[model samples]
Target: MNESSSRRLELVPGGVQLGTGPWQRPTSPSWVLVLPQTVGLCSSDLKEVRRSRDVRSDFGHEMVGLVHSSSMDDFPPGLRVCLDPHVPVTRTTAFSETTLLEGSPDQLRAALPTVLDGTPDDRAAFTEPLACAVNCAGKVLAGSDVAIVGAGTAGVLLAVLLRLKGCQVTLVNRSPERLTALSSTALLREVPKVLISEVGTRTFSTVVVTTASLDDTTFDGAWRLLSRTGGRLVLFGGIRSDWRVPGTHVLLDGIRRGEDVRELELGGRRALVVGTHGATGADFAAAGAVLAAPLPWTAGHIEELIVGRVTLPGLAALLNDAVRTGVDPIGKHMVDIGLNQ
Candidate 1:
């Protein structure tokens, strides 16, 4: 891609920049060039850009785009794809006007192809994260009472998916704005939600923590919300690297490894702990289907989660503001690549 139209979000000291540059074409025919249409701005990306002193690799995953150039027959130049970078494809960077996907035809087709061909870019972009929630939901037994700590996008999506599967879901968060935003949605209007301090005397068969805001108090709240006997705890969010949880070594280790942990005893309380990270190819495919055709009980389409949309340069400013002020904006922010271009 030429320098004029090839803009990307670059990490610089204290913030980010929307820089223009040329992209060299890959020599291998296996590489497919994609023009990103929309990308979901994840908190992890903002956190990394905030801490970095120099430009690093792309942090923009959770994207949907059209195949701009491809030698493969299956993925033609105009075909659309939703990429989950964790699916193991090489050179898969999403935070740019142009990105490359490297893999064999079969591999690329299996991992990148989507059922969301005509779906709007904003909705299709949710494939990656919803797939993650799908992966997390697969671990829980249907119809079991479940509580999700943290009402961020991840927690809200988890609550919707679990509720659709017949599980009773209660979403908990410390922030009222997030909960209020969720309630405004048509699908989750009636879903149960409470503050971390308001989860009084309530317990569930399963509890999932979906935010990185967990500390001693929040962690203790999550633990207390579990049913005393045979309850399962799913750690879906990674703990902040700077914080350490003592006396919960087993659970912490499993979270770090992204693997399941056995039952653990905490002050004579016990619950089976399970950890989940990235999504698989099958999970992506399922997520695409869920977004493309919202089931009757799905409450609302994935597009409802988008709270703000900005262009590449606008995204740079948003990151800088978050880093400078040390506070993150609520809800999902989508980067509209085609805006003001």
Candidate 2:
């Protein structure tokens, strides 16, 4: 394959288009990285394509690649960097390897106090998702009993991180298979107490919902699991617009009874309702710190979370499979863009 050639999986009117093109390279000041097709198979990537109006949009954002070339003085060739796809509005640089360059002078000054003393590449490709999980976990108070409503990659990672913070975690999912997969993770097993259940009836102090398929039943189930006054619920998943739950039951039993049923509070015990958004630079930095530290989970447990690895050439096929079956491979799917793959 030609290094200069462009390869993309475009969404056409009826289906997807995967092929090569003579697409123009980045201009002089802009940098280019050869993101392997492997990154596009993530659940987040699939969700973007499903919601996009234009099928021809670029889909893979959580990607890591060697710097092909750059006109910027700060970034040079052969440096491994992960792209911060969501560059903040106030950013001066177009992109950074791991963190976004926040536009505000005060925010930049705040970051000065926490910058990690490591090279960009030391933060691996998985840093984005890990950072997001870490940020969400931070929102929960220590020792709070937490229930995560999805068993996807982010949900599982969040469960582990919350456990690290001393929270008892009960992973709730529609699929028993995902719970089985979670039980196999050594990281998850090391937690003080972890209960995996397809059925959630008991109320908890806090619940984090992070699944894509949130319907009436899901909402009902989540509301049923919150404590009356101090219960908090955080929505990390993108809920469909068509979803609706009868407010009568929740209002009469939950709020009316003083079971607050409120949003999540990060630093305090207050409940907080989080909007669905991509991770930020601060989130990325926090995730790096966790990944850099040694995980207490066993190797087999970590391996159980890895579903499979595919080369760039096989990405389009894997995505098509995900859409068709509505079931992803057991855990996480990694793509290898390097020549060795």
Candidate 3:
């Protein structure tokens, strides 16, 4: 094999830059499997990095790769595994990915079962985002009246998970088209629902915001969606730092500057603001477990969420379209990266 065959997509100060370099096939400890990537891509990978005024950033966190070589006892050559770009490895594990690169080793990693079975191509690539949505669902109390504000990928998945948990879910998004599209899902078809604009006089026990941009309007919308007392607002989206909120409406969590601000009660209703940086390795593993179980929706029904797929060579062009158009890919964008391609 030629040493210069390795190709990687890099973010540069000017824009994205693709570089082909030498990639060493692991030989040490002999058990480490160097699976060639199959497919990988995600919305977060396409987003602009914060404060990277001059530096380029790496993207594409979601990926399914095969075990090409391995010295580990559990992962043998040709075994299929999901590449968890977030967690790093610290110790040897019989059933886990031994060499960690993204997150700490104590973090959890999971194998891709759907891929192993050779079924849904999109499902294999969608594990990361689905796991994230599942993790968000886990954070909320059971059977709570939940309002998912954002009909994009995460919001739709959250609705499905909440329904599985026996919660009454209401999907609220600015776009009526998106809300309508989500309403067609069997997971949400029978649930209580309303567009954010149509939520004239409705409120929920919990409001989860998953939009890309968080502004004052987003806060106001969340406040309107929450019930007066014991209502909680969970921030699951990226927001601008200068976004402001009414102190009395909700308590802010993970806001660095809000430490001194006291919580306030509105109309005898107390609001709690919860902010999570991102999902942990355990969270991703838990998500995989959910995927391994009977899907919350039928395979045919869930397939409606997928927007499209792109080859590894064409990923840059598709991402460029997303950036220039300011549109979120409805379901997921699968990236094919196998050598056969």
Candidate 4:
């Protein structure tokens, strides 16, 4: 087989640059090389523009791929599939020409059914995050008043899940574009920037922070949004530990009276880093179930948020400009790698 050559997204010091590279074939029997069909352009992709190069440079875990080759019989050549990156096996990078989907020996059993949602392959790439969305939604009780901060991938998906699960969800975001896009499905009430500033003033039984950054403004709002007693704060976007905040280890549930995380605790309130409980293979399966099932009238069009499809190189430009200008993309950008079987 010829060596694979493709455009790869590489993280530079302060931005991402498109670089041509060669992907050598995997020699390990445990690795199965795949060609990514579609990659979801996530908010994290914007963060990667400035993220340290040392951090993993892979972009778009939400993807569908065609098996280029495999030593494992289950995933033979030409099979189309999506993967659970959380699973140890098949956690390879998504943007590469020769993508490796690794799995344990036992996992490589007889031919497994290709994961599908009765949608197109590119649309099915959303299953991974939708799965994580399922995991996050399970944390809150149904019909509970929940506020989801951030209208990015995680936030949007969580909003859909909560709306389906009967929670009164309020979707918050700084951008009117995102808010308008989300409100089209009426999956949840959309909070504009003006209203979001006052989100803390209103009380909620649950507050889920999905921005992934706990900057002072966002943190204060989230802390204030939680109910005084028995209120829960679920970190859909995990907290970034700051030395000023105290310990490296964070106590999600219950209060710690120590100097660190003392102020973060509210009166008898509980905290949870959502998805901690159900990030298992079963959770990924649950995500597919949610997608396949007939959803509520307002919550079924999650795929409508997909706005544009660009190539990997074009995505580099879009993300770089987004990071530089501090502007968020209008909607999800699905990168088409032309990796058709």
TM-scores of the candidates in the order shown: 0.91, 0.75, 0.78, 0.81
Give a tens-digit lDDT track for model 3, residues 1-341: 23345555555553354556455444334234343454545556656422222222325556666655444445556666665543443322111112222221123233322244643545555566767676677668899989988877778778877888888888888867766765667656776666677789778888888886677777677778788877877777666554456553333443422322234455456777666544556666666665554565565434456656665447666655666576645655566666555
RMSD (Cα, Å) for all candidates, in order, is 2.7, 7.0, 5.4, 4.8
Better of 2 and 4 by TM-score: 4
Residue 246 displacement in candidate 4 (angstroms):
10
State the lDDT of candidate 1 residue by residue for 171-208, as single tens digits.
89877888887887876877887987887888899999
- What are the lDDT scores of the predictions, listed in order? 0.78, 0.55, 0.58, 0.64
lDDT of 1 at 19: 80
Off by over 4 Å in 4: 1-4, 52-58, 89-92, 106-113, 186-194, 199-201, 243-264, 267-278, 298-300
lDDT tens per residue, model 2, 1-341: 45545555555443345666553444333334333322424565666445532222325545555544444534455545554555522321111111123334433333222223442322254666676677677667899988888778788778878877888888777757666665646766643233333344567888787775566667667656677657767666655443443542222222212323344332223444443345667778777676554566543322245667765457667766656676555667666555444
> Residues 11-115, candidate 4, lDDT per residue (tens digit)?
677677777767745655676777778878765566666562233444556777777777777777777777665444544456545565555665543112366
Which one wins on TM-score?
Answer: 1
Order candidates by lDDT, high to low: 1, 4, 3, 2
Error at 42, model 3, angstroms: 2.2
Off by over 4 Å in 2: 34-40, 51-58, 88-123, 191-201, 241-245, 248-276, 297-304, 325-327
Q: Which prediction has more favorable lDDT, 1 or 2?
A: 1
